[model samples]
Target: MMEVIPKQFWEGVEQFNSGQFYACHDTLEALWMEASEPDKTFYQGVLQIAVGLYHFGNQNWRGAAILLGEGNNRLRRYPEVYSGIDVDELLDKSLTVLKTIQMAKPEELALLKLGEDENLPLPKIVRSA
Candidate 1:
């Protein structure tokens, strides 16, 4: 049987992909609130992903790394939900991206100007549907 992805889950993903991290966090957190006890861990992991994205957008690399790492940790305990999505791969991608950003020299970081733009960079998810 196929596991149905909830509308709330897709909404949260869209918000995250759209660079509305805070909104993503709020949306997913609500879903987390209503999740059954056995499912709450997965929702909490999603909530952390939102927080990670929010921090990443804000140029808080360390914060993003920490939150993302924690989220991945939570995800490890429940790999069933991620069968088609490959959560481990996603976590690896995120960690690699953050590490690359963090390894840049201070001058490079200054030049990158992490938070100069008022607009958030929407991810590819926005264009899919």
Candidate 2:
């Protein structure tokens, strides 16, 4: 059977994809708090990415650029968490989106799609809810 991703992660991604940047930040931050050392590093990158996405959703190009840039740098330190989860590739696309937005170029933001499906990582609550 396919494993179910953590509810918090899915909730964060959903909030992010749905243009709820603050909610994404809040949800992902919860997950980030409970993560262990190595995993915490991973979640830190993810949180920054979420923050970037939040800024992007809010149309804050400068904020998005800065946070996404940080996220992109953090992404270089990690491998894909699993199949279909290429953190590096996603960061690259996000950076491109941020740069295009920063440059005020007419870019296709729709091309920078993150999955909407609910089937992803394990669904355990890392810390107390």
Candidate 3:
């Protein structure tokens, strides 16, 4: 049986994909607050990743690392493709971004540019076909 995805979820995904991290957080959080079990966790993971990117954009290395790590850990609990999303891709890309952030020295953190980095482009949410 196919699970019905909410319109707001897609809205959140659009926000995330467009680099509107804060808006993505706001959109998904409403769903997360009322969701149950796996979905609750799933929404949280995506939301955290959005906020992590938000932190990264603001040059808050510590916040970016913490939330990205936490979000990746939560998302790992599900299958590679959960809720019609390409979870495997998301996990891989986000982990790459997280690792890149983690590997940066404090002095060099501010110089790092996301999406512009050839090896560490901003992660996007890809819906499974």
Candidate 4:
């Protein structure tokens, strides 16, 4: 049986894709709040990733690193693909971005500009086939 993806999920994806990270978090949280255990954790992971990008874009490296690390940990237990998302790819990109931030000095990180010189690590919403 085919299940329909929630409108909230798609709206969250659109917000994330459009770089409205904070809005994306709010949209997804609306869905995640009512979810059960593992699925709730998964949605939280996605929300964390979005907020990580939001922080990164705004030059908040410490916050971004923390959220990305937390998000990655929550997401790690899931399969390569889950709940319509390409989990593996998302994890890879998140890790890549995290590593970049983790390696930079806090002062250097603050100096880093997003969408001006170096681009922020944004995830692609590749729905699983």
Give me the candidate number with maximum lDDT.
Answer: 3
Candidate 1's residue-wise lDDT over 55-79, tens digit each? 7667777787688778767767755
Q: Over all chains combined, what TM-score does candidate 1 have?
A: 0.68
Q: What is the lDDT of candidate 1?
A: 0.62
TM-score of each: 0.68, 0.64, 0.96, 0.87
Query: Cα RMSD for candidate 4?
Result: 2.4
lDDT score for residue 24 of model 4: 94
RMSD values for the candidates in order, in angstroms, are 5.1, 8.3, 1.2, 2.4
lDDT for residue 105 in candidate 4, whole number 0-100: 78
Q: Which model is ahead, 2 or 4, in terms of lDDT?
A: 4
Give the alpha carbon lDDT tens digit for every residue of 8-117 in model 3: 99999999999999999999999999998889999999999999999999988889999999999999998878899999899999999899888988888888888898
* Ranked candidates, highest TM-score first: 3, 4, 1, 2
Q: Candidate 4 lDDT, tens digit per residue, 37-108?
A: 777898899899999989988888889999999999999999888878888988987887898798887668
Clashing pairs in 2: 5-121, 5-123, 6-122, 6-123
Better of 2 and 3 by TM-score: 3
Overlapping backbone residue pairs in candidate 1 total: 0
Q: Considering only N, C-alpha and C atoms within 3 Å, which residue pairs clash in candidate 4?
A: none
The parts of candidate 2 lying over 4 Å away from their true place are 1-5, 82-84, 105-129
Candidate with maximal TM-score:
3
Model 4 poorest 10 in a row by lDDT: 113-122
